[model samples]
Target: AGITGTILILGHTDPLFLRELLEYRITQTVIDKAHGIQLDAAAAQAGQIPEVHLKIDSGMHRLGIDTRQPEDAAAMFALENLNITGIYTHLAATDSIAGEDIAYTRRQIDAFNGLLRTLQGMNIQIPLTHMQNSYGLLNYPDVCCDSVRIGASLYGMGSKEPHKSNVIIDLRPVLSLRARIVMIRTLEKGECFGYGMMFRADRKSRIAILPLGYVEGLPRKLACGRGTALVHGRRVPFAGLVCMDQLALDVTDVPDAKPGDTVTLIGRDGEEEIGIVDVAEAAETLHVEILCRIGQRVATVVIDE
Candidate 1:
């Protein structure tokens, strides 16, 4: 775990969290507003000067100082307690090639560049500058800077659908979700199963119970045959309502499926692969949301390959 790369926190700053960051030697963080500047000043008064990157609100309207008021950010360079190492902005809609969205992203880039020129006119030299998030880097590679802030793309995921973006990278997924089949049983043709008996077997069927459900971030929307899992290298449909900690998969087609078999919920099995995007599609949400909602109870194993 000796990763010595710079670990910059991209979230907004607060006084209490800033103190904790300083205490842990994580001296670099993003300053999105005047309040964040004050927090850094207080830390300086306490004998710690945290390196910070000023974030300009280049049309995201979510965080960062306003682009119109470059003076507000220029004033921060005077504060000895805050070492302004970098400056950046977030591009709101760089993911879409739609005419309006493209124009909007161009405007954001222009605004951010305008701010940088203003700061340069004041003779303020920031060591690093960047504005590209994952989508921005992919779609607007010409808008380059010292570094880029990539999130989803780092995990081998970019667009919800490949057709939505102009640039596509052959990225291999670095994460997988798997569950063990705890039990397997046969359901009679007329039998109902799960909460509210939402699923009834129309044929004599074999089902495998997995110790994973909504509590584990498996969307309930996938219940009642709407979702599938890979068992013995074949697809198996969800057979009943997904419970708090359990769900049943119709494994009748995979006659070799049995208790203790591995279920690929979001990963590969033999020639079959269930990507995170596939899970997100079935759950009617974004793949990033699916990745973020994975419960803490689920174990994460990092494979070095």
Candidate 2:
């Protein structure tokens, strides 16, 4: 935990949160709204001017000062005691390769650059400027910047359909989700399993019970054979409805699977792998959401290889 690198908070800011940031040694944050500027000014009056990066709303319109209103940003920069170290904007549609999306991204870049030029003419020089997210960096590498914000791609979980992008990188996944098989049993033909008897075995089937379910962030949408996991180096389908704290896998094909064997839910196991993107698709969500929704009960083991 001895990380000496700069930590920047990207969420909305307030007076209380500003003080909390200082206590935690988080000195830099993104200022995206008029309220944020006011908070910084108030902090300055209190003799603690926090380092901030101004965010411009070129097209996303989610946060940041409006691109058309450069005067507001200029005024914020002119405020005394404020350490405005960087400026940035969010690219709205750099994830798509569609012609319309491409043009829209270009317009966003142009608008952001125009604002930078305007600031330059007014003798305002923000030391750093960036406008690229993961897809932005991949699709618009020509739009140079001081830093690129890589989120999903940092975990090698970029767009599942990489063909939609102009650039592709061979990034390896650094995270994995695994669980131990807690029980193994066989259901005779016509026997029902799980809540609501969602699965009625058509044949005598061997299933492995896992200590993971919807409560552990396994999407309920994956219930009833929609999702799979790797057991004994083979893909095994979800055998029944995913319960609150447990689920079963149809390991009839994986005859050697047993209790205590490691089940790969989102990682490589032997020659088989269950990627996060695959889970996302089967769960009808994004890989980002899959990663974020992992329950606190799951132990995170950090391995450096």
- Best prediction by lDDT: 2
Candidate 2 runs further than 4 Å off? 27-33, 159-162
lDDT of 1 by residue, 121-200 (tens): 99988669988888888888899699998888888886555555877678888888999999998999989888888888
- Compared with the true structure, all predictions reach lDDT values of 0.83, 0.84
Give the TM-score of each candidate: 0.93, 0.93
> Candidate 1 lDDT (Cα, whole model)?
0.83
What is the number of residue pairs that collide in model 1?
0
**Candidate 1 to truth, TM:** 0.93
Clashes of each: 0, 0
The weakest ten consecutive residues by lDDT in model 2 span 27-36
Tens digit of per-residue lDDT, candidate 2, span 101-201: 99999999999999998988899886788888888888888997999889999888775465659676778998899999999989999999988899999
Clash pairs detected, candidate 1: none
